[model samples]
Target: MRYLLPGRAAWAVSLTRTIVALVTLFSVATQLAALSVQPSTATFSLDTTTLTIPQVDYESAIYYRDGDPYPHLDFERVDRRRTVRKDHTAVVMENRYVKLTLLPEMGRVYSFVYKPTGHETLWQNDLVTVGGAANDTGWWLWIGGVEYTLPGDEHGTTWAMPWSWEIIENSSRRKAVRMRVREPGTGLEESIEIAIVSGRAFFEARICITNPTDGMVEYAHWVNPQWTPGGQNELTDRTEFIIPTDRILIDERWQENLGPSPQAWQGNPLRFIRGWSRMGDVMADGLTGGFYSAYSHDADEGIVRVFDPDKTPGVDVWTYGYHPTQIPMGSGGPNAGYVEMWGGTSRTYPDERWPLAPDASLQWTEWMYPYQRTQGLTFANEDAAINFQVTPEARRVVIGLCPSGEWRGAVELWRESVHDAADGRAPLRRWEVTADPATPFIKVVILEGLMASEFNDLRLRVGSDQDGWTIVEAEN
Candidate 1:
C-alpha cells in the first residue's frame, strides 16, 4: 500500500500576468469545453441568476455562463424581496409555469423535489451560518439545477427566503452537482459536484483556490449538504468525528440567546449545545436528542446499509448526521458551527492564532460514509467492508500548520442508536476523542475506495467552530 502524496501544481500570485495567462488559458479551455456542450436556453434571467430549460434540449446537460451575467435563456417574471432581516436576500423567477426562489443564506433545501427520475427534497429550513449571523453575508454558491421550488420544508423562511436551485441534464448519463465560483476580487475558483443515480446521491465537491495575485490570499469554504426531512438525527448518531488536535472555536451568542439553560448542562463552548439551546430539555431532557434530531435517520429504508473505506472512514467518521451538538447552538443552523479551511477564519480567534499556512498551501481532507450497520465491527473488519485501504502507493499528503495561540481539535457528530430514520432519537455517543499526538503529527486517517452510494453527499464543512484550530503551521 503506497502512502505517496498525489500530484499537485500551484503558482503563487507573484508569478504575475504570466501565471494569469496560463490560468486563464487553462480556465478558458475548460470553459470552452463546458460551453461547447452546454444546452441552449430559450430564456435566461439575471434577476434570479437562473437559466431555464423549457423541456427542450439540444446539446449536452452542461450550462456555462463564466460568472458573467447570463445573456439569454428567456424566462418571465424576475422578482426580488428584501426581508426584515437586512442581511437576507431572495431572488425569484418562473419558467414553464414553474416558480423558483433563491435564498442566499439558508444552508440547504428540506422539502420535496419533483424529478422525472425520482428525486426527493431534503431539509427545508436553511442554516444562517455555522456561527449564526445575519450580519455580514457571504456569497451564495448554488450548484447546477434547472428547477427549484419555493415550497418544500415549509420553514418560516421557506415563505420569505424560499428555496432556490439550478439544473443540468446532459445526454451523457453521468450526473454532476456544483456551481463553483471564482471570487471576483481574487479569481480563486472553488467548486463541488453532486449527483443522483439509481435513486441515490453521490458527491465530489471542492475549492481549487488559486492565489493569482502577487500577495498571498486567505479564504475559507464550507461543505453544505442538505439532509432529508426526517432530520439528520439518525445520521448524527452512531458517528465518529476525527480532526487534528487543535483548539476549537464556538458561538457564544447562542447561549445568551437561550437564556436560562438547564442545570444539568456543562457548557463546552466548542460543543453543539451552543448557549442558545435547552436542546429540547423539556422532552429529551437528560438525553442529547432534539425534536429535529430525533426525526432524522441514517439507515436504509429496508435493505442493508453498505460500507466503503476509501471514500469514508468505513467505520470512523467525523459526523453521523449534522446535529445541534456539532454546533454549539441547540439549533443546527448555519451559525451552528463548522470548520475553517485555509487561513481565512483563523486569526479571528484569540492568542498567537496566526495563519497556519502563512504563505504556503497546505492540504487537508474529510470524508463521510453510509455503509452497512455493523454495530460492533473492529477497525480492520470495517475497513474491508468500506473497501478503504490506504497503502504506501495510495496518494497521501503530509500537511503542516502553525499551532500557536488558541488552538483546539474536536470530533462532534450526531447518530441514531435506533436505526429508524424517523425514530427521532438524538444521536448517541460512539467514541471518545482524546488528543494524544506524540510528535505533533496526528495520524492522517483516510477511508479509501468509497463507492458513490456508500455515502450520500461529500460535504467538507468549514467554519470556525468557536474561534479556530491551530495546526503545526506549514514551515519552510
Candidate 2:
C-alpha cells in the first residue's frame, strides 16, 4: 500500500456556465481494475517477533495495608536505580493497508503503522520507566501505546504485568490474537481480540470484560491510546483534536490552565496541544457523532477512532504538556510529547462505575485507521470519512473522501437541498471516481459568478447508484 498519490494526468470538466472548472486530483483507476477481477475472499497474516527493549530497572516491594482504606488492593513501591535491556514478545497482524503490533508482556498495542505511509500512528517510547504512582498502583509504567485500563482508577494494576495470549484465528479472510489478563485486586478477566480482515483499512479490537466473583462488582474500563498521528512518535503545534462534542468537562486540577468545565470547545485554545502549559485531562460531556480523531496540519495526516457513542459515551484527552520532565525520563528524550485519547464505558472515571453481575460479561468493538490529504474532518463512520469545506468569499468548494475499502461511485454536488427522489432536482456537478484505503479522492470546484450566499446551501452525496447515496452536509 502506498500513501503518496500516484502520478496521473489531470483533466477538467465543465458542467455548467457557473461551474468554471472541476479537477479530479487522486483516483485509483488501476487499483479498481485489479480489484474487480480478484476473489472476494479476505487475506491476512499473523506472526510473532522478539524485540530487545531498553528499559529502566527498579527494585520493587509489594505490601498489603491492613485496616487501611482500599484494604483489598496491594501496593508496590519501586527504586528506579539503573537502565537495562530486556527481550519481549510481540505479535503482529497485517492486511493490505495497516499493520498492528501487540506486546503480551505489557498487554497493550505497541505500534500501529499505516502501511501506505509507513507511519506509526501510536506513540511508542524509546525507553520504558516505571515510577509514577496512581490511585490503584503505587508504581506506573510510562511505556507508550494503547493500554486497556480496568478494575481500578488511573493507570490500573495489570498494565505492567505479563499477559496470556493465543492465536485464535488463522483463516484466510481474518487473523487475530487474543490477550487475556485477570486483575489481582478484583479477579476480573479482561480479554481483547485484535484482528485484521482483508479489504479493510481499519483494525478492530473486540474487548470483553468478565466478572468471576460470586457477587456483583463495580469497575471502570477504558481503552487508552497515546497518539502521535504525525508519525515518528512526535507531536507538533499543528496537531488538532477532532472531537464532535459541544461541551466538555475539564479536570479540576487543570481548570486554571484549560478553562472552566461544562464549556464550549469551539474557541478553546487548548484544543491544540500547544495551548497547554501543564498536564491535564479533558473529557467530552456527550458525543454528537460516533467518531473522534486527531489531525496534523503540517503532516497532512490523521487517525480516527470509531466507537458506538451509546455503548462507550466517555471520551477523554490527556497530555504531558509541551515541556515536561517526565518525557525525558519515560522515553529517554524530551521530544516524545503525545496526546492520549481514552474511550470509556462510563461517563467519568473513578466517579462513575458500571456494575456487573456474577458470571456476566460486557463487550464492545472499536476501529482505528489513518487518513491523509484532508484539510480536516467533519464527520466519520465505519464506512468513510467526509471532508467538505466551502469558501463563500472565493466561490471555492473542496471535497475529500477517504473510504475504508474499495469504493466505485458518483460524487454529486447539489445547489439546492434534495430531500427525496421525487424532488425532481438536478445536481450542479457530478464526477465518477474510484477510491480505496490507500487512495483518497480530492476535488476543488471553482463555481464562477455564483453569489456568496448560495454556497451555504450546497450539499454533497457519494455512492454508487446500486448501493444508494449518502448525503453529507457542508461545513464552512
Candidate 3:
C-alpha cells in the first residue's frame, strides 16, 4: 500500500501479520430486502461489502432570501420570525451507530447524531433565517450544521436553495443518498454523495463540482461544519478545537482590531477563551493529513472532520469574536455561539482564487466521525478513530481507538527506534489486543529502555482477515 507523506508525495511503512494465526472474515449473504417503503432499512448485503441504512424524507419550512448581499450566503431579514411550511424538504439516514439529517434544499447536513453519545455532532439553528453580517461571503446566514459551497465565494448560492436528490442501496451493502444542484447564473454543477459504512460511527461525503462553460472559471469549494464542542445547544468555554497543522495565521482584519502586537497571542491563542473576546478567525495551513477535530474534556466526546488536502487544502477556524456575533438574530437561539471548522480550497483569504478550465471537474471526499474520548485526538478518518496522549518526560503513552467496522481483528502497538529524521525506525515493545467496535480499544505502555522522544514512531498495526494489515501511527 502507498502512504502519502506531509509536504511531500509519499512515505513507506511496512506492517507484518501472520495470516493463519489471526484471521477473521465475515461471511457474506446471498440476498437482502428492504423492510419499509418510505423509510428504507436493511442490514448487511449479500456480498457483505456494505450495509444498508433506513432513509426517510420530510418537509421543513425554512427562511431564506434569493440574493447575495455579501461575499457569502446569508438571509435578507435577521429580525423576521416568519416561516413558510413545506418551503423545503429534509432527509434522514440512519444505522445502528449514527443518524444523519440532511437538507436537500442546500446539500448541507442539518444534524449529525451519534447513537452512542446521543449527541448532535453539528450545531443546528432553531430557525433557519435568511440574513446576517458580512464575511468572506456576501451576507452570511447562521443556519448551523455542515453545509457545502462551491464554484463561488463563501456560502455559495445553492446553500439556501433547493437541489435534486436520490437514494440508492447498492448490492454491495453500501447505501448512499446523493444531492445535486446547478448554480442559477453560472455554468457549474455541484453534487454531494453521502454514505455510511455498516455499523460504524462515521459518514463520508464525496463532493464533485463541474464546469460546463466554454471559458475558464475561478471558484472555491468549502465544506463548512459549524461545531459546538460537547455537541450541546450552546457553545461553552470548555469547548476547545484540536487541529494538526504546520503553520497558523490570524485573520488580518482581526489583527488590525487588536491595536498592535498580534504576534504575542500567536504562541497561545487560548487566552481569548472568554466566549466574548471576538478573537478573529484563524487559518491552519499545511496540515499533515487534512484532519481537524474538536473535543471537550468535560463531555468526553467530539466530532472529527477529515478531508483530502489535495482538493480541499485549507482548514479554517471561524470565530464570531466571543459574542456570538455570527448570528445576530440567532442570539440566544440554537444556532447561536458557534465556531466554524471549514475545509475548503487552499486559498485562505477571500481574495484568493483557483481557476478551472471549461468542462473541467473537481472531486474530493470528507469524513465526519464522532468518537468518545477527552484527551486529545492525534489522527482520525474512516479507517480508524484514535485518541492518544504522550508525556515524553513521564515516559508514558496512552492510546484508544474506535476502529472501523471491518476491523474485527487485533491491534498491536510498537515503538520504533530513532536514528535520523528521514530514516524509518525499527519496532520494539509488542503489545497486542482484540479490536471490537462494541468496546473501546485502549492500551498504555511504559517504555522499558527507550524514552518517548528517542522512538521514531509509535505505530498501531491492525491485523484483519479481510484487508490484511492496516497501520495507524502516532506523532513521534
If both were scored by lDDT, which would come out higher, candidate 1 or candidate 2?
2
Q: Write the per-residue lDDT of candidate 2 for residues 321-414, one digit (tens) a residue.
A: 7655445333233464788888888887546788989999988898988888777787787777778889999999999888887878988998
Ranking by lDDT: 2, 3, 1
The 0-to-1 C-alpha lDDT of every candidate, in the order given, reads: 0.23, 0.72, 0.57
Backbone clash pairs for candidate 2 read none
Model 1, 312-361: lDDT tens digits are 11110111123443332111222222211111112221111222232343
The C-alpha stretches of model 1 lying farther than 4 A from their native spots are 1-121, 126-135, 138-173, 185-187, 195-201, 226-276, 279-476
Provide the TM-score for each candidate, comma-separated.
0.31, 0.84, 0.74
For candidate 2, the TM-score is 0.84
Give the Å shift of residue 189 in candidate 2.
Answer: 2.0
Please report the candidate that would top TM-score against the real structure: 2
Candidates ranked by TM-score: 2, 3, 1
Model 2 scores worst on lDDT over the 10 consecutive residues at: 17-26
Model 1 local distance difference test score: 0.23
lDDT of 1 at 106: 35
TM-score of 3: 0.74
